[model samples]
Target: MKPLQTWVPVPENSDFTIYNLPFGIFSVAGDAPRAGIAIGDQIIDLAVLADAGLIAPEKDYFTQPTLNRFIGLGKKVTNEVRLQVQRLLIDEDSELKKNPRFLVPQSEATMHLPIKIGDYTDFYSSLEHATNVGKMFRDPENALLPNWKHIPVGYHGRASSVVVSGTPIHRPKGQVMPKGAASPVFKPTGRLDFELEMAFVVGRNSDLGESVPVSRAEEYIFGMVLFNDWSARDIQKWEYVPLGPFLGKSFASSMSPWIVTMEALEPFRVKGPDQDPEVLPYLRTEGPKNYDIDLSVGIRPQNGEEEVLCRSNFKYMYWNMAQQLAHHTINGCNICVGDVMASGTISGKDETSYGSMLELSWGGQKTIDLKNGATRTFIEDNDTITMRGSAKKGDVSIGFGEVSGKILPAK
Candidate 1:
């Protein structure tokens, strides 16, 4: 397939390509937030296009702060809208090309959370990440747990704290058992970290007592977004015994505004790592379950230069999204549209490919050298963390812009 040239001028290496029309909510000035598609440096306002009788369905689904309603309309309608935008972009005589009002500059528009999440689930699916963590705290020889290869381990997380990119997160104060302390002390986290991840939005609702098969899991997914699952190492280290993450992780999580649809990612699909001993029937999946997305993390201190921390790929996942969704629903758990399921910290084989600061610094034993003559084992105040992802094939590229957040003093 050849890359389609658009009349809309796209700068070199811009994430928003003509072939990738990611959806998000955007507003300029005092106007209400509405659905729009990202193309180059401009946002194609869906509301304006619908009102102009150009590429609308029976009714306008773009008049909302959240894309839940529009996404709930199913992929048939959503994919058609994307196709319509693609057609209009390439055809020079189209009304979209004539009227530039609908194309809002991304600089002027404010990007918002694409969906109102009802539920959130974070999965520990990366073999390298799990093994690295196990080696740090548990046994190095038996790094992987007994059931690690069998199921997609996950836990429910706080949906209320999930914010869009540029949102600031304050250091969460919680109980921590300091080194050699008899008891725990309540204070701000000494070791705050960011987990590089990707999350898929649920596009359809499932009925109670119904299980979606692994083969058909993609049918219920709408799109993907770059996710940053912020963590407090000390807070989690003490509390993640009987139950999983609480205040340590619930305080804040950030997501990229634009959602790169599964349709757009179809070209970048590849087979995931082989599962030894084979998965259960419910978790079995066919070819090319994982996407070959390049992921990177960068951190910048206040008034300092940014430093790239780690570079990993989504293809390194031991468990894929289909297995996660299928395993989640195997017990008859129903999923709703806008429910986010995050792929836990994606780590690779190399030392530089480690996802979290805990792994990168070997649990605070070593310091990470920064660009501005600074060193860090964990995040500091005013330190900004950004995560970006992109998938590229022969002639096509799809980007999940970025999820960024700056840390603030503990409140």
Candidate 2:
């Protein structure tokens, strides 16, 4: 099949190809943020088109500051709008093409958080990541917890702390127990790290006491984004005992501005890793559940060039999104629109493919050599971490552009 063609001049290697019309919120100089779609190097201001009666004429969801309203319209309307936008972009004679005012250069636009995330959940879905961490902190012979294979372990995260790409985060301050110390000390974290992840946004809300089944999980998900779940390793180790992550995680989390819809990723769908011991009937999925998204993480020093630290893939995850969602709501927990659920630390089998500094550096026991002759066991102040992801198959290629954050000294 021929890839979709747009009138815009998209570079062959650009992530925003005609086949991928990812959505985001953008604001030009002196303008308020509004919904927009990426096309090549330009952003089609959906608000402009909607105001001009070119699309979604019956509704004004595009005028909103975030994508929550538009996504809440459900997949039928959202998918229709996506298809119509594709048609309009491909049709040279279409009014949208003739009206240049509706298009804005991406360089001139400032991106914002695409959605108003009401709740956030981060899941430990990567087997290798889990094993690595377990071996470091627990018994090497029994690296994986017994319940890991049967269920997707996750914890609710701070939605308010989730920021958009380019947002600088302060190094989190928390209580930490130094090696061989009896009590903990409260101070800025010395072991800040980044967790390379991908998150899906929920489009439809479920009533309280209602559960979303695995079979129809895709229908509820709007799209995905590259996520960086910043971690305070020392703080986490000292506090993560009876319960899960808290202040060690809640300080900050970052995500890319754009959301790549599931439709754009359909071509890259693949079967997930085999579930040994067989998952529960509720967690079983019939069709392809994993996506073949190439993922990588890069770290740039305060004054040095970016160094690619890790290369991994979304397919490395043992538990897929569908299973995670099903397990999340199995106990009659309701989900809301704009909820963000992240795939925790997508590490592969190889050591270099480890997702976090703890795993990649082996809990700070080893140093990762960088280009500037600097070595790092954990993230340093003023260092920036960026994560990128893309799915390419045949002529179709789409991507979750990237999410990056520069670390600042704690106040």
Candidate 3:
């Protein structure tokens, strides 16, 4: 496909374009969270368009809060609306394009939580990341724990605490067991970190006892976004002896403002990781349909210094999105629209490609030298972290903008 021309005046240097019609929730001032689409530097209000009879849902879906109503319509309408919006915004013959009143400047728009997530599940799907993390705690003989390669390892995450991009995350207070301590003590997290990952938003619900196959998994996916699952290493190390992470992970998770539709990313799908042993029947797919997207993380200190930490790729993941989704509903689990599932800590084989601060610092042994001469092993209070992703195919690039969060001191 050739490059698309848009009247929105986005320069060649710009990442946001008509090709990437990302969706989100935003209100003018004090209204409830409603669906909106990003175009150029403006947000096209979906609620307004729906009210005008421009886009109406077949189901009584528009009544719900967030984008779940429209999202429950599934990929059929999602693609339809995306196509309609693209035609209206880019095609000169479109009625909405000719009308200047329909456009809203992005600077004035107040972005909010795009969807009301019912549940959050994060998976350790990246092969290199898992190996790196395992290498830190485990000795040379037992790097990867058994059962890791057999199934996609995951844990239920706190949904209520997940925040929109730019939200402030206060450092969490939890019990930590120091060396030679029989009991744990309560204190704020000292070794805070950011997990660089990508997550997908569920578009359709699967009824209990009904499983979604890998073949039809894409229909249930609405879009992709950046996800930062904050971690407190000290708390996790002490508490996660037998059970998985609890308070250290539940404190906060940050996601991007705009969600890039899967349709927009269709052209960029590459071959996914090859499974050594045969996967389960439900998790098996015909071919690799994963995208070779470039991912990078940046950190900014409270003192006003910024440094690029790591550069990795989504292709490093051992499991694909389809497999993850298929496995999620395999056991009669109900999955609702707008439920978020993240691919945990995407890292590459090289040292420079570490995704989380824990991996970058090598379990707090070495110092991560910054450009400004400052070094860090874990996140400091007031530090801002951003994760971004993009897939470039010659001239055109598919972007999932970025997700960012600022760490604040505990109350």
Between candidates 1 and 2, the lDDT winner: 1
Residue pairs of candidate 2 with colliding backbone atoms? none
Candidate 2 residue-wise lDDT, 226-283, digit = tens = 9999999999988888898989999999999999999988989998889998998999
TM-score of 3: 0.95
Q: What would the TM-scores of all predictions be?
A: 0.99, 0.99, 0.95
lDDT of 3 by residue, 165-186 (tens): 9999999999988779898899
User: Poorest 10 consecutive residues of model 3 by lDDT?
Assistant: 56-65
Mind giving the per-residue lDDT tens digits that candidate 1 earns over 1-411?
566889998888888998799999999998999999999999999999998988866445898999999999999999999999999999999999999898999999999999999999999999999999999889999998898988899999999999999999999999999999999999999999999999999999999899999999999999999999999999999998878789789999999999999999999999888889898888888888999999999999999988899999999999999899999998999999999999999999998999999999999999999878899999999999999999888879878888999999999
Tell me the lDDT of candidate 2.
0.92
Model 1 clash number: 0
Off by over 4 Å in 3: 58-65
Q: Which pairs of residues clash in candidate 1, taking residues 3 or more apart in a chain or in different chains?
A: none
Number of clashing residue pairs, candidate 2 = 0
